[model samples]
Target: MPQHHTLYAAFADRIDAVLTALEHEGVLPPGTPRGNVSVEPPRDPAHGDLATNAAMVLAKPAATNPRALAGKIVGHLEKDPLIAGAEIAGPGFINLRLAPGNWTNELHAIAEMGADYGKSGMGEGRRVNIEYVSANPTGPMHMGHCRGAVVGDALASLLEYAGHEVVREYYVNDAGGQVDTLARSAHLRYREALGEDVGAIPEGYYPGDYLVPVGKAAAEEFGDRFQAAPEAEWLPIFRAFAVERMMDMIRADLKLLGIEHDVFSSEAALQAAGKPEAAEAWLRAHDLVYDGVLEAPKGKEPPEDWEPTQLPLFRSTRFGDDQDRPIRKSDGKWTYFGADLAYHMQKAEGADELIDIWGADHAGTVKRIKAAVAALSEGEGKAIPFDVKLVQMVQLLRDGEPAKMSKRSGNFVTIADMVEEVGKDVVRFSMLTRKPEAQMDFDFAKVVEESKDNPVFYVQYAHARISSILRKGAEEGFAPSADNLGLLGEDDMALVKRAAQFPREVEMAARTREPHRIAFYLADLAGDLHAFWNLGNADTQKRFIVAQDAALTGARLFLAARIGQVIRNGLALLGVEAVEEL
Candidate 1:
């Protein structure tokens, strides 16, 4: 109903209006492309409240110099009552200063929206299938899977807030060699459960104690029916049972970190339904697949036994991969990539877009999978936007040294161990404080520290302080009131300006598919709130509550409440709680 509720969007519309007016007057040619024009907050606050490059972007098309074009645009901008001033900077950048009342109006909007303050509708309700944390069902979730899980789950929530119909999915890799090993591992434990005196875990099987429960459950169900049987007679039954138990364990581990997937598509089911065969036949029909021999593996010392072998290869090289990839192995089983291609095809059937959050270790496979999706899009005659986000590994530490592994997993630290040590909030927030592609350290000591250096603590502390101030105000016979918002001053507006960036940040992060941006923005917002609160210590009159001035206190209180609301909304997107107290 409103032109725009957020300050940045409203100003963007205003700038577009100025451009349209210039075109009508013939100063700028009609139909000049404005796609590159941008309206955003200046990098340096000293420049102005908002800055735009409309003139520079339009100058060449309009056959005019940027500065001359900028002057005309500023003339139209300055006529708007909401714009206090419009200045032409170096080149053709136009900087705009909004009237104080505009900031006051935004603060009111924040209050009116509450939890929905930064919510966006830019996604236009397009269905998005995001497959994340699809860890193999061979073992419990360890720290190795932690980063992708957090990044993917947070990105899912971020997209939902930006108004997309998001389907959170997990692709269960049960039809694989890894699950075969898990079956053997569970079989050994089952033997021990039936009092067979099973020796030390053999070299190639999982050794985690977590499998003991699965083995016990199996022994109870079948009562040693498959024990001492041939590998063929028992492998399938054991694999099915072990994978189911492992998935249940994975689900519980994810719940500890506040994550749940809407769909768990099984690779075994895909193969049973011959989806991979369908994909291969379709590819063959389109000449996207052929019988080819892959060159020997490339390396300083190629395997001496390596030889060219004919296989069914997908034309991944045509789509930017280094070489055509084999879809089936010499043993006649589908390769992981082949199964994955079919899985993505299945996902694309229900969604407008596809996204996968994978670990950096899987970076080598990115190009081929992207190529497969592109090929599928070509055959389908419709463009399906696809993205693969890689999250680097997180190094765990205790007090500055590498943390120890979990005894239960007997391999690496599990997500449950990390969440139990610190908290879900700390684990989720700390994982997000840095960009996912960059390496990060999750020191148990530093994450739980009560210092400003810890982002989660700092942001949560800001929310807690606001809660305390509001409670104290209530006890002192006062409450936040917008009746005297006009009494607010420049220092107050500065905080409001920082709070106002949430909506813009939301859209930018969603567009880039980077949920970590939300975490970075929240840290900066919290820092601003902290600095504003510290002002009270040096000057009592600057405090949120002025004992002698009720109206001013109410206005400041109102500002504080809205700022807290924004912090809560951001933390929710990150899957972290906003604690009311430290």
Candidate 2:
């Protein structure tokens, strides 16, 4: 027997004890490795409640037959008070069925914990920095940036539920050439704002009408003083003004999706502080960077004017990268990778773990960044883990046709327009329906439809249905109370078993850094609740409300309440609301 607060943890601990007992009995060698042991729910419910592959995994190491080892393990598991039966099935697997009362106890735990039921301490309060949706400070955020925003926010929430101190960060690309173009574009608009016939926007400048207002704002604030000024004088002023205004637009767009980063690190600020140069100097002293003549990139033709020039490069290949990455371009200017390396070096100083969520187009860049972090750790003699999660594109559809593109952001659809069309909740939920790295389609018609195929609607309706039942039961003078919980039968216990998996699912999602798993789990749990509710329509005896039997009605209603409680908790992790009614 093992003492753990959660059901799965208890079983896992007990399985470990069985292995240790086998070691003590001389059935296996002392100090045998048990990393491969896994206790999980069987795929087929008919197999048993819980299944362990301890024997199958450890048999070869113990110099024994798997079936024989399974028989020995089952004997020890059968003696546990909570286990009703233990049997060996399917090639050296031990399946154990818990007593029905154990599920009732688990339900009681849910009732006591309420919204906090699924939260776990698996992360152990480790500091984790999650950087996402780092759209450039050029214009408003478009639909292309929506998936990473939702995925990152939900992941932060999920990690918090699993006990990690998560820092939501956004890196602002304010120092790049994009912002320079924005400045020149705004300067053109600024000339027009002063009633000048600036003619058409120049070929290289941004053409979006959104910047017209930014120029107008600058004119109203600073007057015509900047119009007659030289390019050198006005360029910095316009760049600063345009970037601040664009960042404001980005913040407002993110607000519509309920996302606000804890820290907005600026690349310009990093460069201004000489961090990149300092990092380069540190790397050079450590022999991590060297002057090198690069070979032409394979699989792609080199530029016609390409020459074998000596430039600074990081030894990324030593850390598993495909090739040595250049830290400085041939022009002797620090490249974007150099700035990012310093940014991550700063991040590693504060956090134990770093996660950067990027759009799928940046997939080719993952290895070099990982190598940089690995080199940083090796140089500092302190290990820091880094991961990059790439979110794929989302194709928006309406009535099976591509969505109308937004003129506000030029060719791309703006986040504001999407939110205005289908509401923020639908947009957030739909973006998360598929894995972050897997491309998906968001159909406006399907997302708002009342059908069960719409995951958001399906999961929300389940919670709404439960609330309606609780209200109906209340009006009929039947209320749920803990004292009458034992009246729930085996069928109700089955639902509790499903609800009990929430904690495990939360841990798994957090461990994998995939919040979509929570959405999927909630969808399945919602399906189970819907199926359980329909059982009442076919048989009056299965109804949750029994007018003449308050005790039985109370027990069933308590189970329903637990189901609703779990639905709320799971939805909260995804930042979706659990509605009281459809």
Candidate 3:
């Protein structure tokens, strides 16, 4: 059996062929534009199993009215046994009802595919590098960083399932001033660890007590050897030591949310390798950078000493940025954008596409980075796709009130704290319930509540209920097998149609680079399952396991099993568990 049915794709292709035949018969123009043609499940099931606006889309170009063209298309489609009924709807739409055996056959096909059911070849194994949650190596990951982490991870999984070669990467900001602050903070903690009473943490440094352990670890390793050294001598040493420990803490915190990156690219390492300098030289040779002075801002107040000075700058304006961006500071250090450009340059060499997930605060940075990427890829003689998805802030709340800050993570709540409070599953699921760009409140009360209003619980309960039906079927000797699938009726067939949409949902989510759609799709699927199960409660004969009718019960069980399988498949892409019992 094929790994994916793609019934919609198959019918769409057949429709195109029919259109070509219609053209051959001289019924319409020879070459009609088929690009806008779409075959999708009807919004209202009463319309038909599937609907198409092909005639409406092509009618104007073909110089014919929609209903007339739809009639011709329906006439051709009705001749096929696969299409049981094809009728013209309002305007030019053609609604198609497939043979009942098609649904039963698809149910068997889905069961046969198992875990591989929804896997699509849409990505064609193209290399996609996804960089996300590159939080600074300064302290524990806070709640502010949670959304990007979950979104990135889920997007990576979604892409992988869609048949892309995906890389989950973290860009460590260890070369920046943040790590410098972390180093100094750890140095003070080191002093406190070595019998010296370090007073309250310095105002400019990290005040979180989480650094105490790092200071103790540094003292244990070096044994006060650098306690009396000058700041110059110990700053780099402590910076390197502290950055590593901070990353370890970050990784552990991410683990609490079930996130791990395949690569952790270090900004310091990129700088040390002279990658920024190399990128600068390349851009200069290509006339993409020059030593220039930038003008003062027009809309906003400029700095007090806003006089222009000669500095290396990238021609970001060439690719739609508001102004050319400076690549180097007055003190000759590469700016963050400079290093970021180098990093993206290196990524562009191997990756066919690059996706970055950043906090919404960095929204202004998107244009320049995209310009840099466009310039780099333009120089390469090929267009490399690059997108930056900004994840908005997540507000932590308890019982509709703002949650208390975590002392362990300083001023904000930690990812670990959230995970510990709810669970890895709840945290991940809640993060995706909304789009990454929209701010949301992660209410502690709403998430863990066992109610249909809670999407995570609702979806999970559907899977558990399906499992219950199957278990009861097994106990009553009505075990669901693909054998009696033809016995399924209108309700069973409707459920199968919903289940068949899994592959389409995966492809759609992957194409949009939005894993949240998977969550949305699963919720809808769960609702359908719940509604179907409720039907059984209204009529005992509709129950999954009938005490006397083993064959009918087995067919119903078959439908239930496929529903559960598709749910499990969707949840897998979202990195959520499909519980057998809630």
Ranking by TM-score: 1, 3, 2
Q: What is the C-alpha local distance difference test score of candidate 2?
A: 0.89
- Count of clashing residue pairs in every prediction: 0, 0, 0
- List TM-score per model, in order: 0.98, 0.97, 0.97
In Å, residue 312's CA in model 2 sits off its true spot by: 0.6
Report the poorest 10 consecutive residues by lDDT, candidate 2: 1-10
- Candidate 3, superposed: residue stretches over 4 Å from native: none
Off by over 4 Å in 1: 1-4, 300-302
Worst 10 residues of 1 by lDDT: 1-10
lDDT: worst 10-residue window of model 3: 1-10
Predicted candidate 1 versus true structure: per-residue lDDT over 1-582, tens digit per residue:
122357887888888888899989998889887888888999999999999999888989888999999999999988999999999999889999999999999998998888888888888669999999999998889999998999999999999989898999999999998999999999999998998998899998999999999989999999979888999999999999999999999999999999999999999999999999999999999999999998777665668887778999999989888889999998899999999999888888888999999999999999999888888876898789999999999998999899999899988999999989898999999999999999999899999999999998999999999999999999999999999999988888999999999999999999999999999999999999999899999999899999999999999999999999999999999999999988
Computed on alpha carbons, the lDDT of every model, listed in order, comes to: 0.92, 0.89, 0.89
Query: What TM-score does model 2 achieve against the real structure?
Result: 0.97
CA displacement after TM-score superposition, residue 69 of candidate 1 (Å): 1.5
Candidate 3 or 2, higher TM-score: 3
> By lDDT, is 1 or 2 better?
1
Residue range 1-582, candidate 3, lDDT tens digits:
245748898899889889998899877687766888999999999999899999899888778899999988998998988899999998889999998877887787778898889898888759999999999888899988989999999999999988899989999988988888888899999999999988777799999989999999999999989898999999999999999999999999988888899999999999999999989998999999999997677698998977778999898887788888899998899898999999999888889999999999999899999988888898889899999999999988999999999898679889888888898999999999998988899999999999999999999999999999888878777778677777777887778888888888888899999999999989999998888888889988877887888888878887888888999988888888899997
TM-score of 1: 0.98
Q: Of the candidates shown, which would achieve the greatest TM-score relative to the real structure?
A: 1
* Full candidate order by lDDT, most accurate first: 1, 3, 2
